[model samples]
Target: MNVILPTVITAGLFDSLNPCAISVALLFIALLFTLKKDRPFILKIGFFYIISVYLIYYLIGLGLLKAFSLFGATHFITKIAAIVTIIFGLLNIKEYYFPHAPIKLRMTHDARFKISEWAYKASIPATVVMGILVGIFEFPCSGSVYFAIVSLLASKVTYLTGALYLLLYNIMFVLPLVLIFVFATNRVVTEKMINWQERQGRKMHLILAGLMISLGTIMLLLYF
Candidate 1:
């Protein structure tokens, strides 16, 4: 999990370049404003929100790592996972360009509130839970990358190394968002970028979604 964290973070940052990540972040800010009009705390709240979202995403990745491991590299399950992943990837591509056929992501909160409160100081459990949530966000993209990375590392790397990879992957995926947050913190430019993202947002989503499905299909085919 330790090493996989980095991989997942970097991968996540890569995926973040996709328009979907931008849209999600934008939507979150919009929602925040709707709830509390122009509150000064928004930027900070949004910052934590990004952290929380990424944390959740990273954690979800761990489960994926385990599932792929159980299937291994040379088994029926691996073949099937590969097939399904490829299919999902292709489907994502189709969904990307078609405005009418958007990919539907089902998100679940598996974090335990009580335990999180108890573990708040060091935030060990909280961080793990956050990563789990982030990983589940994987439905729309990275099927190709996911398959390839997992398959390649599953048999060879130690669990900690894998975790590092995951952490890095997610960090990269969210790097843009991190940057956006930084830019937004600026009083003058914040509104402009947000407005730009809001207006031309769909392009990002479509493109990123396309990348995920296309690459996922490739990885699936190669592995199979």
Candidate 2:
């Protein structure tokens, strides 16, 4: 239990630093600013969007957990997840070094376009839909930590307990978005954040690469 708690928290925090989700979130903030939406309106839209992300991600976690339990192959799946996480880490490292590589872990062009289209609307419902899109599309780039954490939970805990940990993990996952939304209410702050993210984007991938590789190695050693 002690090990699980720290693992979940660390994974969630690291995953929250994902460039895919952060870039989209910054874009959403920038769009709302461009539309001349007031702070309250922006906050309202951001609130719903963040909620949509949280709900979608939590539900997805639930589904994964249930699937693992149903299959009664938690050990097998955990081993596979560990290996996949290592592969994902290597891919992230590749992204940092060779961003233009033919294979990339990122949202597709079409997904980005769709998200942008909806984000331009700047309506509460539209933002919610866009959030859902972000949640779904950002998975390929940002889901490795989540997949590993979920697999660990399946192997180590019961369904109900794992569900509670999922709640904690996801709350941690969205904490940065919440902070970003709140601070980005200021245009200058928003611009600076955007700049910061651009500068540190590749570094974020590198960090994730290291963390994922370490976690995967640890999981393999301890469980497999």
Which prediction has the highest TM-score against the true structure? 2
Q: Name every residue pair that clashes in candidate 2.
A: none
lDDT of 1 at 213: 52
TM per candidate comes to: 0.63, 0.98
Give all candidates' CA lDDT scores.
0.54, 0.92
Per-residue alpha-carbon lDDT of model 2 for 56-142, expressed as tens digits?
999999999999999898998998999999999999999999999998999999999999999988888888899898999999996
Tens digits of lDDT, candidate 1, 40-87: 555565556567657766666666677667755534444454566556
Model 2 error, position 222 (Å)? 1.3
**Prediction-by-prediction clash tally:** 66, 0
